[model samples]
Target: MTPRTPLAAAHAAPLDLGGRTALVTGAAGGIGRACALRLAAAGAKVRAVDRDREGLEALAGQTDGVEPYVLDLTDLDAAEAAAAGADVLVNNAGIQLVRPIEEFPPDVFHTVLTVMLEAPFRLIRGALPHMYEQGWGRIVNVSSVHGLRASAYKSAYVAAKHGLEGLSKTAALEGAPHGVTSNCVNPAYVRTPLVEKQIADQAATHGIPEERVVSEVLLRDSALKRLIEPAEVAEAVAYLCTAQASFMTGTSLSLDGGWTAH
Candidate 1:
């Protein structure tokens, strides 16, 4: 009789993804870029999608397994098609408009929901067939603390994230029977280009200086006073894709520095 390899030995360390394919939206920068690099390091071939051509070029240059796919996720058909054949999906693309609902433009709000909420639905629709056939898949939605809690002057952003949280939970319930898992990593104020822009916009809207925006507004509810690094959020995302996390579906991993504790 042939001896079987130990399960622990096969699982190993650093969470291997040798032949898997990972699709990451908004991969040109911030949490998306960090997730792409981290997954690539775990041996997955990463499809790095974003609208920024130059940023995609730079991202492709930094890694061997990353294939940059420049795309505006508002093109829903194209976004769905881009997700085909992925063993893992990270829905991280998002947009922000900082204005009170009464003052918010209907067009911008529509665009935000289109990109953040609708696109993920289509991508999942496209990816599910393959995942179900293979009987294995991972979906990680890079949601925000705003998904679980509301914030002022971010009506569209907050609404979109809240919708995503619901979508993620629904996916988890349906995908469980097919050996797939869906979850959200909810982080607060990661040090990303998106957050940098938000700081400036918040400052302008609140009549506060940019420096004060971080401590006075953003970190006002948190037990920790610093902005989370993109890598830290990416690590949480990577963990969701690991074998150890196979049972962790339909849940939100809060990396909010204890903001929700309030």
Candidate 2:
């Protein structure tokens, strides 16, 4: 992953999320964790939701304003229930598996759609009443370049993300009348445990060494050579929650390193 851009070091107006209750899924690590911390830094009381007990505990230890909520998103009802009364929602939990469509397991495909697509629907369902009632809310879906484009051997992930893109746009339309803004930040590959673990699998699937996977496979379509940092993704999420972005919804912010520019 590339180091934090020097441009970000320049001082700018600070985002203040004071008094807001932000809920971040998959908050145990990576982009989710960075978002939780960033929101906390901005004075929001962040509810860090994740299935990883140890990771959540660690996150709580590192931050003063975070409350860790441990729950599996697969339990859609529980997932929905957990989003109750949240002022800001970051839907960031996801799982990926790469294989030829013919060889992909049926059960895994269902799980992917369930976790990535259906769960977001339920979470939004649960969150909407509160958001609508308050006449203010933010929904940031952590989509990907895959959501807008296709790559072989990632049918389930691509399909789930594509469905999520549709869901996000629909929510934006419905949310418009209710003072809620829904949008997606579509980032390219990021440096996360999930992506790190996939390196070997990608190498194996593409018939390349692990060392070559980063340069040749991952960056093949990217104009920028380095993987995005989780904090960079978090910064984009933070910007959406600010008043400056109140008018921006039902759209996508691409952090794809020009992948979709083609």
Candidate 3:
């Protein structure tokens, strides 16, 4: 017996991303901000990308090893270029427009698809070469409950998330042979600016008061009637980067409070 391998030593070691480079898009705030900080804490140098220069500057002020890269993901070429040479790629940038399909502006729909779906494809494409050469990488796509289910007046968001899920799975299959893993983290109604902005829109769309939006609309299907914090979602993203999750790819880790349980 090898002294039982020392349970604490074998199983309780902290996640260490020492010397790794992590590229996180939409890192100016919310989930992306949380992820940047979390990975930095784990000893990875984080390349934080976003269009929000002020926000990125603010984020960089709070941490060491976080380099702010101001680039809007809608610029497909730039988005791809920014992902080069990253050991970890977190595609977490997205925008939403809550409007019925019939009322949706075609230009906005195109923009939504371009930013949310096409940008991730380009980023993953850019990341794979470096990852494959090194034979290890982690890709985490921050998706939403909308990726699996749908709600009225959220056509563009639903479409983008659905597309993201498909893209993530495809990457998982292709990258498996190269020691890279791709996965999605689907969270519902996070307590972030995105969700905060949606309250008024959802209220108008559902013909309800804004006060009722949280309880009656957002949490209606959730078994746990609460909004998830950005840090909570970031923890899941961090887990996927660890060795324990090496075999878990091409699937979604839903932090939906059982929204999909039904």
Q: lDDT values of the candidates?
A: 0.95, 0.93, 0.94
- Sort by TM-score, best first: what order? 1, 3, 2
List the candidate 2 regions with Cα displacement exceeding 4 Å: 1-13
lDDT of 3: 0.94
Candidate 1 Cα RMSD after full superposition onto the native fold (Å): 3.3
Residue 42, candidate 2: alpha-carbon lDDT:
96
Candidate 1, residues 1-262, lDDT tens digits: the string is: 9986567854647778899999999999999999999999999999999999999899999988999999999999999999999999999998997998899999999999999999999999889999999999999999999999999999999999999999999999999999999999999999999999999999999999999999899999999999999999999999998877877999999999999998
Worst 10 residues of 3 by lDDT: 1-10
lDDT digits (tens) for residues 1-262 of candidate 2: 9776355344446788899899999999999999999999999999899999999999999989999999999999999999999999999999989899999999999999998899999999999999999999999999999999999999999999999999999999999999999999999999999898778889889898988999988888999999999999999999998877777999999999999998
Q: Could you give candidate 3's per-residue lDDT for residues 1-262 as a string of tens digits? A: 5544444443545779999999999999999999999999999999999999999999999999999999988889999999999999999998888888899999999999999999999999999999999999999999999999999888888999999999999999999999999999999999888888899889888888988999999999999989999999999999999877887999999999999999
lDDT of 3 at 49: 97
Sum up the clashes in candidate 1: 0
Lowest-sum lDDT 10-residue window in model 2:
4-13
State model 1's lDDT.
0.95
Alpha carbon lDDT of residue 52, candidate 1? 98
